[model samples]
Target: MAAGRLSFRNITALAPMVRVGTLPMRLLALDYGADLVYCEELIDLKMVQCQRVVNEVLETVDFIAPDDRVMFRTCMREKDRVVFQMGTADPDRALAVARLVEKDVAAIDVNMGCPKEYSTKGGMGVALLSDPDKIEAILKKLVTGVSIPVTCKIRILPSVEETVSLVQRIEKTGIAAIAVHGRFKEERPRHPVHCDYIQAVAGAVSIPVIANGGSLDLVRTHADVEEFRKATSASSVMLARAAMWNASVFRSQGLLPVETVMEEYLRYAVQYDNHAFNTKYCLCQMLRDKVESPLGKQVQAAQTNAEISEAYGLQEFYQQTQDRLQTKRDTLQRSSQPSCPVMDGDIITMAIKFERREYPPQITPKMFLLEWSRREKLEQPRYKTVQRSQDRAFQSTVTVAKKKYRSSLWEKSKKFAEQASAIVCLRVLGIPEGRLGEDDSGLVCKRKREGRSNGNSEEERGKKLHVEAEASEPAAPAEGEGPNHPTQLAGTL
Candidate 1:
């Protein structure tokens, strides 16, 4: 392997799970002992369009190095170990999108083995498996387009010879590695994974070959991985659901207790802001061994990440699990007692402690919880302040819109007044009246439309006209005849 490129030191890698394999999960795997880790498979086009997906899946450092690509996804700690996998059918599209993210990853992997309908329907994933020529072209384009090494992950074909031939053909395209999932495309989780075929493919390919599938059994995952490597003769072993159950499978020290692993994983979840579904799925997997426990039921029933976290109560749960394990250890340590090597519940923890007594003391559960709590507390106020700022900004926008509306209304009223005043001036300055008529009070003028007053109804207009006529005509005097002195003459008459 070249510098800054992928090197399988431990030969244990994390598989690209669609929802479950996130940045936090990769980080957890790295901490445990995975030599290489891949992020979830992203569709080339969708990955380019959806920044929310990027944010949800990838977590970068607080600040960036000068040469860092803005789309860089992983945190500072695991940048060198993370492989970005994309699903694409078109060579142009693959090359175009590959350039967008090549600088940030250790290597770029083409997802050639997804069996789901959604993936196949899009002419990507396992759909590419049917067309090796197209796959070769895609790999060629990607290798030429970006500086990073390109790899492809594929499922096995029916025959071992055909599978080996397929790997050999793909290796000719200059892919740095080939990740072979032992099952055929039509195979499901319930089916047994065929490691014999994976071994055949590994023997065929000169490039690094990674074996994936059926390595996620909870108790036997680590053992299963060892068996898988031995059986397949693979350069590396990739884990999907197994790492979710307990990331510690990568460590040679053996598996940690589920409670201990879950607590550490939750801390990573908070630290990385993993998607809720990812968090929930991991929680469910960890609680599998404790299915009869109330905590397991509570975790299953929880709808949100916060609720799940609360139900687990990391510190309290770890304390209880550790104490129970410790009690079991004390019980076993007694020489007088009948020597039973394995106790029932916390055998995993005992195995770990017995293998390496210095393990628990190195990073105790309390220490991890305390560190996570401090970080959470520091982040809370910052989050609250951001929320407050957003609220204030929203309120300000509404206020500005309201003011604009009021100003618009006022401007319209002012313009209407000016137009009305102009019409009145035209009438007063000897311009043609054109049937313009004022009301009796002279406060408002009614314009005539086709000889009918616009302001009043027909009956009211007739009444107003009659009143105007009576006012215009000379009024008949009272029965008395003359003006001033005639008053006396009228009285005499």
Candidate 2:
């Protein structure tokens, strides 16, 4: 709201994603542009013993100056679901984290909105918002224990009056600032954000009260900031998916080095390359839009980042990369100018700029069948063992007669039935079922149903399934089928 550079040296803040945005990503922003980086929320118990969790929270980030602030949000291992945590209700535990804050972080935050069942069982987050005294005690101790500022992010409670009352109580505890997501903890992502409640909390709290919720598009980001300025007189609004949605949109308003912001992001994210496939896989996503650009097209042609890096002569690869992007400007300028062939001597009326045909996104019948199989959990016909198991679990509803009838056949018919069932489930799932596992050829499960009109053609898909079954069946090991490989249970089964 204040020209994209509102100073937060002492006032409140807006750290958009309360979860999922890894520490490395936050650290990158701290380097690129963030007043303070909040580490991914840490379960206080895990905080005490799990370095792995701590390391995960710390990955891919370094936005802090030697003297700048880092904030650690204390949380309960609500993922465990075995206990009810009353947030940082335990003053001693809250103080222990506050002490950690004293070491290197710029500040400390107490999480009151984790929405996890385990956290709820522990009586923390929205579950504990009802108990103001516990919230009060935790904040008081945390504030008293830490030397730097303390902040709170609340996923607006279901009850407006209750939230406002809680805000008043929260303010009494001396927290420096508070942010309220417009939706209740469980309702966001699916339900629309409710901005009015944020306005109420902002009005109720004397300290900087930031409003958060829907209208997070670029236009909405600015509008929310404007709204916050008008409603509660807060100076700025936080950007969540709004900024991340189009991470570069902030550049011109002084978000220079936009490309590097993304590059740094890649550095942080490249880890967790679980299958060694994710790094390239994710880079492809980041580059998807960039590739549509002129320079991006060239970068994508490199096939691999190493090639792109070699082409650009830079190790940190990004398409339409900052360094090489300039060369494209001239080409783009030339292309934008009208190109006339001067057909029949007169300037061809409208530079019939052959609009490149974009591939139309289409879903076919087999895909529809696969979706059905996933959603309806169709039975596997070839494997009676699997059909029986599905019947016991009630996961598949194929009639017992169908299962018995299919199983009575030999390889070809049985395989056809199983493929039919899988295709049916895939159709029910309607998207793609679980991502093609590692065995898939780059998961390219393209089913081209362009010419076939008759239902009879489905038999071909069944034939392919039969081939796969034959391939997977154990070949007699000279001595003949004594026992198949013990670890052979995985595949289409």
Candidate 3:
């Protein structure tokens, strides 16, 4: 192995299992004794459209989709040991994705062993295995374009000679390693893995070969990992079901009880703020046949992380982690504020953010501002939002009546930043943004009261009176209408 490059020699790795190779599980695998971890395979098309975001609250780097959902999340801890496995058939799209994530991961592995229809139909995964030319093209592109090591995982062909021939061609692309899952394209876990065929492929290729698909028959404990490695004559062994069942299988001492492993996994889940549903799914996978047990049933019924933690007797840990995250968020917010005054052509701005929890469900400040604009027969509000490159935070400015308003506080999403700007505009105009009691009175109505206070300067008082006089006439419902009777705005905001 070269300096700054990943080495697969004599290592135990976690195989990339869809929906099972998520963050919490990968962290657990590393906490045990696994040498490397592969994140779940993400499609190139979906990955290409995502914007990278640095999440200060969770201390993770997030790839956010257009819908504001996190497609992938990784922290600095796994930057050197994590393998970003991607599903792609096109050489250009594959290279594009490789370059996008090259800095955040140790290596990029192309997934070619998946036999599912979704992958094959898209000319990816097992589909690429049949088209050797496309596979070579994709691999060559990644090897030449990315600075990190490149690898691929594949299922063996029916004949050892054919698989060896294919791998020999793949080795010419200069990939650092290759993983051979000892099964044919149509074979499942129930079918026995062909260790002899894997040995043939490993023998033919000079690059490191990672042996996979041994969980069902060979791998169960730490010693089995070496046995599987020797059986296939590969440089490393990757375990899927065995590690998923009990990550501590990587422990040299022995396999620990599944219950103990699950508790440790939950701590990582809570610490990382993993989604409740993903945590539950991984726990259920650990439970397997025992899902009918009382603890499993309790976990299955949980809707939130707190509930899941309670089911595992980790509620105190969950609460402490949440409180710590809140404190970190507040600190980051304060540190992110501009040291100097913010000015847009001589207009000073105030810092703000749209807190969804502070408003009634389905009601937003943007909706209210748009309605107020229409009722007063003014131009519709227009928002210009930009994402900061340093931390991927979003800031938006909204223009109404030839005046611009913006929030200095950066938001996690563009939609939220736009709403924040709208809140600033509504507050300055003395318009009710939401109901007082149902919503957070301090945030929703604080500015409305400030606009009417005697502490305002004469110039500020004149501006407020002018705006209120313009909106006083009955062109529509009054500005102070409560949340129960908000003016309906057409179309989605």
Ranking by TM-score: 3, 1, 2
TM for candidate 3 is: 0.74
- For each candidate, what TM-score against the reference? 0.60, 0.46, 0.74
TM-score of 1: 0.60
Better of 1 and 3 by TM-score: 3
- Whole-model alpha-carbon lDDT for candidate 2: 0.44
Off by over 4 Å in 3: 1-4, 339-349, 352-493
Candidate number of the best TM-score: 3
lDDT for position 311 in model 1: 76
Tens digits of per-residue lDDT, candidate 3, 331-416, equal 77868776343676744466676887886544567757876887788987877766654334667778889988888787767778
Q: Candidate 1: where are CA atoms >4 Å away?
A: 1-4, 8-10, 50-73, 216-224, 289-293, 314-395, 398-493
**Candidate 3 clashing pairs?**
none
